[model samples]
Target: MDASLLREREAFLRRAKALPVVEKPRAVSNAVNDLGPPPTKRIASSVPSDLRSAELRPALQGKFAVLSSVVKYMKQRHLERDTHPLTVEEILEEARLHDTPQSTIRWLEEEVGLIVVTKE
Candidate 1:
């Protein structure tokens, strides 16, 4: 085989691999947004507790700042805890409830107090 022919074949293969054809779906407009009274549902708040439960609805909810403050306070409680040392199971359980490990640790510490911390 000619050396030049082998080189040409390799180049052709590389080109074919690089420029494979693709068929993308076209964007379809349903023509629905302008034909209705808009959505009737309200967004729910994140840190919903009994104290703020009444204010969680869209009609009564405050700004995101208030929600953020509640989250910050929750986190602070976790960090400042001197209770028991957090176990892996307890940590995982807390994480399941709040979707955050830090929040779980704080909550567990709050629940058990001195039991969760170590003496040393």
Candidate 2:
């Protein structure tokens, strides 16, 4: 770190510390602060919770988690069994997503770059 930058940062810290002592603390009100607590009940819900539940939407739920698991499984398999370049089917099976859709699989290939899925 540069000595000038360190001194400037120290000056900034001193200014910040001095603020509380120099000025009288007063309540700064905002809409959220005025509100005591958030409503426990769902206030605006046209969509039901069951429609958004993971049990109903297995393919969309925890996609990043699935990707991470697939990568970890692949790495572990390669380390233990000398496997290379796992197929998407193998990945899906390892992740136990037997009923994952084609579009999501295409996303794993195209958007996430897990593999290149060539058309046969």
Candidate 3:
């Protein structure tokens, strides 16, 4: 092919390969308009001072009982490798599981104490 024809073909190919450029609108917002309202903060009620308050004692006793039941079960069932005493948190979790009934708690405490004494 001749150089002039080749040059024309290259120019046509270049024009075909080039893409059209377009400008997209930039996102813009006024600071005053964007700042519409301030966030609201809520304060929680203070905990009661009385340990035996209607809301307090039952929750605590229930938790304690639940934990005691769980701890006793763990000792008997060997749920974990550690044989150390159950922490308040573990007892609470167990209590949570057992629904922490007062009777269950008292029974578990008695049972656990007896088992401990027997083992010793």
Candidate 4:
């Protein structure tokens, strides 16, 4: 490297400016605490044996149709992988699905016939 180039680089480094100090953001002790307590899940004690799809509200029935599509999608994806059986639990739990309805499990077991909603 040339001595003049090195001297110019050194001079530039000496004259370099710095950004003004900014206060750091307050650290949360627990990030989850900021969100408040997790909402309590409405744990279904038991799904009625005689619950009918038609008995459900129109909007809810539409959601069931969507849920049915999800089950079919899950089943199709599973079938593509291998001949292994896909269950209601897998469909519910798929794609990090947490908000799936409890009654859907029974619907899956009885309506879709994949089972694994509960073990006998």
Candidate 5:
């Protein structure tokens, strides 16, 4: 390397080293302190205990029984050896054969605890 280049490099390095370092401002916790406490999580009860004791209309009661029978038969036939998750579509199809109303199926699942509908 040339002596002139070496001298210039050393001078530049010395000047760079002498320069003061600037640090980024750190986030202060006091910014969040003014926001107040975090929101409390709400606990939701999925299944109500008093579902069985609830009275149903005569027509609904009959429909529920029909749906229950159909589900029981399907469980025995399709899921005898291994456990199989039943879908709403399959149940609805079977219920259609028995002339069960779509509303009745929804009622059985939502109101009555006879069937559980879970998200896939």
Candidate 6:
């Protein structure tokens, strides 16, 4: 080996040996810390009876049929235009243009299995 290269290698070894060792930080238990305390039995027992009695309203069922029709129409329009699949935003915009309620749009996306295209 070259004398300069041998000296540089020795220097590197000396510097490495002089460096202080570091210990890894201990892992923290996140469940309790993140969620805070569990709900007390008294809090659980005090939930209102009216909440338990809540049932789906008949009006909502009709909205599903309307949304399905709108989605069908939107699909046909896309097919006619030879455009890419409708995005959630595009669907919502069409709904808004036709005066469909924001809540109805949300219900269609969340509960009625509306498929949306995401940006690639």
* Best-fitting candidate, scored by lDDT: 2
> Can you tell me which runs of candidate 5 are displaced by over 4 Å?
1-61, 94-98, 116-119
For each candidate, give its TM-score against the true structure.
0.23, 0.42, 0.24, 0.33, 0.34, 0.35
| lDDT of model number 4 | 0.62
Worst lDDT window (10 residues) for model 3?
Answer: 111-120
In terms of TM-score, how similar is model 5 to the real structure? Answer: 0.34
Clashes of 6: 0
lDDT tens per residue, model 1, 29-98: 7657545777789878666587585455422433333334444554765788834445534434443333
Q: How well is each residue in 6-75 modelled by candidate 5, as lDDT tens digits?
A: 9999999999999999999977779778779998999875657566333342234676576666667667
**C-alpha displacement of 34 in model 3, angstroms?**
80
Candidate 6: Cα lDDT at 17? 100
* Candidate with the larger lDDT of 2 and 5: 2
* lDDT of all predictions: 0.52, 0.75, 0.57, 0.62, 0.65, 0.68
lDDT digits (tens) for residues 16-98 of candidate 3: 88967689986676766687787789876586656336454334555454545555767764756756556434554654553
lDDT of 4 at 25: 95
lDDT of 1 at 64: 38
- lDDT for position 28 in model 4: 75
- The clash number for model 3 is 2
For model 2, the superposed segments whose C-alpha errors exceed 4 Å read 1-60, 117-120
TM-score of candidate 6 against the unseen true structure: 0.35
Q: Write the per-residue lDDT of candidate 4 for residues 1-120, one digit (tens) a residue.
A: 999999999888777744455799999788897988999999774657456533553335554664656757777787788555545666555533445566765665677665563434
Those runs of model 1 whose alpha carbons end farther than 4 Å from true positions after fitting are 1-9, 17-38, 41-120
RMSD of 6: 12.4
